[model samples]
Target: MLTETYQQPLLDSIRVIDHPEAVRRFFGLLKELIDIVNLPNGDARLVFSPSRREKGVISADINFFQALRIQRPPHRRTGRGEVEYHLTVKKSCQERLASIEELVFEPITEKSDYVAVIIGQSNAHLLTHITLRSCWEDCLLELVESNKRGPHSARHNSDVYRAAEDEALLSDLIRLADDPTLAERGQNGTTVEEPEADYETESASAQQPHNLILFGPPGTGKTFALQPYLQDGNASLITFHPSYSYEEFVEGIRPEVLGNQITYRIRKGIFHKACMSAIQLAGYGTLADCLNDTPENRHRRLRKAPAHYLLIDEVNRANVASVFGDLITLLEADKRLGAENELWLTLPYSQERFGVPMNLFVVGTMNTTDRSIALLDIALRRRFSFREMVPDPGVLPIIDGIDLPQLLRTINERIEYLLDRDHQIGHAYLTNVTNQADLCDTFRDRIIPLLQEYFFNDWSKIQLVLGDNPSWGKDPEQRLIWVRKKYTASATTRLFGEIPESVDEIVTYEINPHLHRSEYDQLPVETFIRIYQKPTL
Candidate 1:
């Protein structure tokens, strides 16, 4: 008995076979012809007419029209014949061919010879030049049921009973294909396999258009990581800051001197220029050029165009609300140049129609230490995907017995524990240290000052990170006290024991907040070395 697995291939075989015997095998069995319907993609459907002798007409959906040859081989006593034909079905469409499993053929004797008659109805027609012969009755009846409640019980339950499992799997595939979360994931960004500092070429998996923001602590190589994509000559680079605005980004009316008189004229900003360039590269046309646009020409131009990238450094530094203005909606994938929901607007100043090109992809870098991402615009945040680029101490090269990577990780771990991840120092801070002196200078100048800013002059937190105790007198036997003399009395003999008579009553107090910047500066370089000295393998 033919099951789904066997019947599917048989249908595929019949669809591609052009042999006359293969044709006669089925056609000879049919008592009448119905009609042939042509499909949109150059496939055809054959319909068999229902007769009084047959309960239902059989039909097969096929792609046999593209077959190059149609000839029947020698028929055997067993009634199976081999035939060859052209045309190939794409692997993507193989499941669609399984519709043939619905067909059933009944054996009928005519003039002492047996013929097979199709005994089922289907939305799908029959494949041309392919038929079920007398010897193939078992193969055909396998598709039919026996013992009809009425006389025609053979057709009962013969209609394809679609497996619930296959239907469920297909439903799941359709749901996944249309999932809104999947689109959000695409908007957010591709996964990073390496440290953000290591700028590899954009991979094939990363080709889709998305607004990606690489954000992390300072010196995590957010800016440096964009280099590889920019190498393609399709990139436009810009730096966003607190002062950057819509006038500097999209378009604005700028004052220009025409000879002696000053006049204002509409001018394109950096983003506007980039968008225009992207549109040109994307083969989007002006109303005039579209008049002559043909499918062949458009396809040719589309093949030649490359994706354009807009790299924004320090993106979070600029006020997104002021910089994006009305253009923010255009950043969505659906609103890009060639998308279904593509949008265009007339420039307020120039009155020119403009739209963002589909080819233009936006990549931005954000320094988390400089600004809190929580403060970023919700609208902008929704439009762009954010991937955090944390410092990878492993990428830091060791220098002067200082395992910089391990040390940076240790310091960041402490900072993350004490304060938060945003306050953690990046490995880039320590990467410049080549010798002990450079390391010391880095600690005194960059690292210490930054820690001071992070801790707000609270030396206790800094001391904790350095594995030092701010309460030095905890070891009472070995103590060093710093004092500030506020006033002097007239009668004192000695400084420690008794005051001199000439010294007017003096009062001294130990300064609790004496852990100054100078104290941090004077801290021995060995102190840092000792703090992180537990060797990391």
Candidate 2:
């Protein structure tokens, strides 16, 4: 009967509600309710009763709504007594609500009699909250099914539910609460998550630790791996170079001109801004709320927020210890703002106490070719969880009878043998090869140039990697690197007009000139095939 009378209207109201403001207010109210009730297991049945003294339990009555600035009229009876108007949870739903570790309330409208219970887990930390209408048995069943299949799949099938701006607003709250710097900025603060980027469906498994480094050589898709996290516009990308400093990565004093006077002020850097964004996304209304809240409360609240990323491209280029400074300790999972052993540091310029937010993930792309993982700062090594991204030849397709996978495998094998695993050529170099021309261009323009740099202009090693060595017994025309040899006596005579009897024979190597030709006609598909091909016995 309640479903027939109020279900459709409630669903419609939820669809059109000012989700951002509603979510903000909902969390604020939820916080107050939790604080007032102090439910031991973080579960409670809130009864909005008219009587201030309701025996044993605390009545979430007029004062509760008034505290949150929610205006409600006096009780009006239908068929039941004045008790029928009080907000009540169904008997069947009570067990289900009690089972949920953390209960987040989503307010549909100021005038709505029912409060929607959004069930979420602390571990998965999904951004989309599955809104379960109060007293609706069908909605509760759907919530259980959705939780089993995951939020996105549940959202996909549900007709009555919409993630909408409520998700973003929840994210904004979480981030604000997690980062004190953003809390210090107050309501007027600007965050990286604002001006929402295009939405993307992120999986529960994609939620990684607070600090992760994707380390590998060039073209290994280290930076590309971060696309899923960035699509939601909660990510900020910054490239680290030799010149990158603690001041630039964190906070620094910068010059500003006002009127005719040049004055300096402390400016928050990308990391600082990203932290603020992450904190704001976590759901605290103010800095005091973030700072004063217990770790358990913050962690529970953060579970509702989406994960934010600080993408550091070329992470190894900057001095890790110098760039991260004292805040490097906060990068650890246990030392983040809401962790068990939370830590904080006073920034050099701002002097504001700062800690990395639990939801702010630091995803860094480290080019091993630039700086090996072994050489990374000990402090950095201790903080971040490193995942090595190596060349996966299986991802390459065979193009025009050329096995691109084998080609990449062979190149990487030779590179590994000549140098180390870190210098291996990535499969991405040949991923786009569709035909003979593409292969030829790849070898000539990209592969050969990279090998030259890898070997530091030592063409002989390049020749070996390309299967151009004399020992391989390949045809001169077919070789990617052309070799030239001359007797020392003849070479001396050519250069100085005299032959030296003691001089040894001379050898030289060059990249096949035809590869530089506009058409790339000289280097056929066979040239690339031979690099990976073995001579028949």
Candidate 3:
């Protein structure tokens, strides 16, 4: 085990290595350095130690395989037995730590002034190769640099080889590791805040809302609206359901089975991956990228920040309170990737600091009929801008036999009157009707079943929306219906001393809607076929 006495003295002798022997020494010392820093858990939890003071730590873990383990019952594990006294230990030592997939490394022939000894376990529980020199520094620098030709200079890389010239250089090294912003700031200087009007103009020109929900009644093309963006690789799609949780969407400790043994691992969820990808695509090489006013550079940076869209289908299906977790604050427009109010989070499972990027846009689709938007979590609703995607009958191609748009509008208007706008049918249902048979089939199958569910099996209310001719009464709202049925008459009693044998008879009577009669079943289909029949030119 590495001890306090040998740690600080070793940091003074740290050097960039090119030779294989020197690389071996680097890894040997790296293992000891990791032990001394108390990073066995794959996260740095100590800011100040016997060997170091206020050193910033960046914990990056890589995985090459996948596995599954129990998710419901969280397991307990042991940690360093001593009472830890460290400012960076935000969580207690006894807290369950995430078991992440072991990183796989191979040797690369490249040289650089610095190396990032990314420490991780392999699937076989063996130490993978130390990514030496060029590869190593690239890995380390990627945490800060947005692209090649970033802020790092030869002098900055050589500083780690020699003893600290001053306390300030040590502070700079820590910042370079932990805070990318600080490194960028040191290279490009500070950023001047832009006027609110200019910021608003830039935002409007982007045409991408940080968070948006596209919603309306069913079949309003809410999901279809995402196709153009998805085709361009600008959008990612995910659906939320009742079973989704913060652990699945954000981050959490999940169990994994590796070679007949159970192990826990911290896994990155879909949202986290999207945010990281957006940050990389934003082309934010330095603070200058944000503050530079040169027309060509500004335009290049803005264009380089390709908007990433996260389309959430059925956004309301999941428990919003549980799924969003701490992400609620980070989803704000100003808190986006390159926004002025950008925010970062120290993930609970991996203890890694992460933030949402501005270029990543969240687009969600919801069917208001299934669940009312008004009942949604106020916090989630406030974070997203809502766009109404009601039925647009005018966009449909003119069908040969049917006045499709008019029919849809009439049905929706009736539905709106009977129930509410939320339950109205969308125009897409009738947009493809080309003949009487097509119209009949649509009404009989898709349209009626949906209406039945919406109205709780009330066919009469459905008929009113379809504008079917009344069969039993003048008023469409009337619930009573006349029906015909076959029954055996049982009159064996004598009225005036005479008796009669029982006989079969057919009867008709007015029955209440509670019985839910099916006598008018064929009427709606026939009526729709007649209305949709082609007219002579």
Highest lDDT scorer: 2
- Candidates' TM-scores? 0.51, 0.62, 0.52
Span of ten consecutive residues with least summed lDDT in model 1: 34-43
lDDT of 3 by residue, 351-430 (tens): 76676766678889999997888999899888889999999889765454456776677778878999999988887787
Q: Candidate 1: misplaced stretches above 4 Å?
A: 1-209, 283-304, 470-525, 533-537
Question: What does the lDDT read for residue 115 in candidate 2?
Answer: 54
lDDT of 1 by residue, 404-521 (tens): 8777887888899998898788777877777666776676668777877888866667765754443421221111122345454323333345654555544343312312333434
Number of the predicted model whose TM-score against the real structure is largest: 2
Order the candidate numbers by lDDT, best to worst.
Answer: 2, 1, 3
lDDT (Cα) of model 1: 0.50
Worst 10-residue lDDT window, candidate 2: 153-162
Against the unseen true structure, what C-alpha lDDT does each candidate score? Answer: 0.50, 0.59, 0.49
Cα miss at 513, model 1 (Å)? 18
lDDT at position 422, candidate 3: 91
Error of 2 at 109 (Å): 38
